[model samples]
Target: MGKKDLLSTEPYKGVRDFYPEDQAFLNYLIATFRGALERWGYVEYNASILEPSEIYKAKGSENEEVVREQTYTFVDRGEREVTLRPEMTPTVARMVAGRRRELGFPLRWYSIPNCFRYERPQRGRLREFWQLNVDIFGSSSLAADAEIIAVSHAIMMALGAKQSDFIIKLGSRMYLDTLMQNLNFDEVQGKKLLILLDRSSKMPAGDFERELGEMGVSLEMLSPKTPPQDVLDVMERLKMMGIENAVFDLGVVRGFDYYTGVVFEIFDTDPKNSRSIFGGGRYDNLLALFDDEKVPAVGAAAGDETLRNFLETRNLMPTYLPPTKVYVALTSESLVKEANKVAETLRQGGVAVSVDFGEKKLSDQIKTATKHKIPYLLVVGENELSSGTFVVRDLVSGEEKSLSRDGLLSFFLNL
Candidate 1:
């Protein structure tokens, strides 16, 4: 055969290759948020990443950019259009609609799943990342909205974030519609204005005003008004619930087409990560795409990339801890079987143990244990086998102690 070509080792652009240390940090994030959600009676659910393209293409699912430009769409051998899901809201809505009759009302569900989007890779944007999606369905109560916001706040707090570290910006589609009607904008203008306003924060003030001027609407007309009663009630509920950081900002219009009522976004207060972390809003009519029935829902999603950035900027990243608590090093090749037996014994006693079968030097074995961040190291050899005792060394503190095999097992089990 001729010379073979080697494939590149790099992963696809904008995606990540999570080594052990990286994975540990991700696990910490998921575990922390999941614990908070479960405490609030939010059960977990998941779905396949592949979804029918039509779901996102529907007018009520996602924004136009996602469906037309950002989704990873393809055709299978059978010629059916498929898309890797860019978000979880549409998928969850479909599931609820599919089992509308069998399921109980007022469901609170959350999921952390990997999502794909064909977008430019930047500080807070990626082609692929995992997200935590929390939603409440079947309830039109503004209490459900408050609960959703409360759950989100709890997640940040659980991750050791203070209320001053972030602020919740709330808004409503009902308020926007009233403003539009008073501006005498037709249907086309209203749609255009919403799109422009969605992007207004990214544009300079002069440019935003110039664009409004071109549309024959002055910036003064867009001034904030008294929020709709629904928005006010939700804000009051949030305040009563002790979520004191929430504030009304008409500019919090999320970039989703399906949001029908209240909307909100969370902003990191740190200057280094001063940007919208994540947000969701009420999408009462999303189920209409499936049938005439209406299901009111409000939810939000936290992306891992932005969440990690937030934690790192604030020095709140969790320390890495290896799952294996002890490393059993072999002093000689002759002790191979005994080493495994000791490892199994500790494992049966509920201690995570790793056996060093290579029979390297004692110093090298200790180095290996330290490299893997294993806390305790035990040496198994002929003396230990004869005396029925093992000496366990603390890799972290450099403290060593001699104990009977039974004592070693009990010590780790209790720890």
Candidate 2:
């Protein structure tokens, strides 16, 4: 094909192509969150991106705007409607309901899955992104709610975030429902009002007030009311667990229709990234869509895009370090065999090694190592091979240390 006919190098709009460095940062984020979740006894689970389109269309799972507009949905070759999962909660609910007869309850499950949405790409909101979802099933107690919230706090801290760096604003759907009932809102009107409140932060105050006026409600009527005891108890428990930043805010109505009880959002304290990092809440009725049986569940998901933005805003993003620990630079083409032996020895000792194979000048080989950010450089030349000793150069510090083969293996292994 001619140049004009060549495909553009750019990724599709609203999605990302993760280059090595980008993937390394994503790995770091997933690793940190995975460690925290596993420590809390949460096991990982995953499912395909394609799920039945009707799952999102279900009344209790997602709202109509998301189902009708945002989802990447189409009829598959099998003549069945399929969707690239826009979120994970419905999929997990389906899985749990499908196996409810065989599974043990109070399940602590987690998943890091990439979700898709057909929306305008913006900071923190992408058309394709990965999310760390942590959920607990078969528990209706407030402790389950508290524990799920605590897991969010723990994951944030694991990423080197301080309590002052973010705040958990708690709310309850039950409390919002009560206020709506007092305002005499019927079910349809109540749904509209909740969605309006969920978008309140993004809309202008005048617009919000005018919309509430249209709904025959006033700003005063929506002002902060006392949260239900379930919300208060979760907040108290989080405080007792040393998560002091969690506070009750009456405005936190999570966008999903599934949330039946206490809901929350973790917001970055820094004004530069001023938005909810992630949020979830108790949804006891979602499983009912599959059958009459209801399974109580509480969970939260942290999006990789939003989490990275939060870390970058606060300068807490971890540095990307290549997995290769040392690069073997050969002095001459004749030394390729010796270089391989040295590389193999290091590999046997659990040290990541890369051999230059005398393809470049020794100095250029060292430059290649530096370019790749490999921490150590080992020059395999005639003298080093004859003496059975290698000089390992620290790429960062410019320090040199001579060691025998065994000593070199021990050094890299210890490092």
User: Which candidate has the top score in lDDT?
Assistant: 2
Query: lDDT of model 2 at residue 120?
Result: 89
Candidates in order have lDDT scores of 0.88, 0.89
Q: What's model 2's lDDT at 103? A: 87
Tens-place lDDT digits, model 2, residues 184-225: 888788889888888887899899899989999878766656
Q: What is the lDDT of residue 330 in candidate 2?
A: 90
After aligning candidate 2 to the native by TM-score, how far in Å is the CA of 276 from where it should be? 1.2
Backbone steric clashes in candidate 2, count? 0
Global Cα lDDT for candidate 2: 0.89
Across 3-39, the per-residue lDDT of candidate 1 in tens digits comes to 4676778999999999999999889989987899999
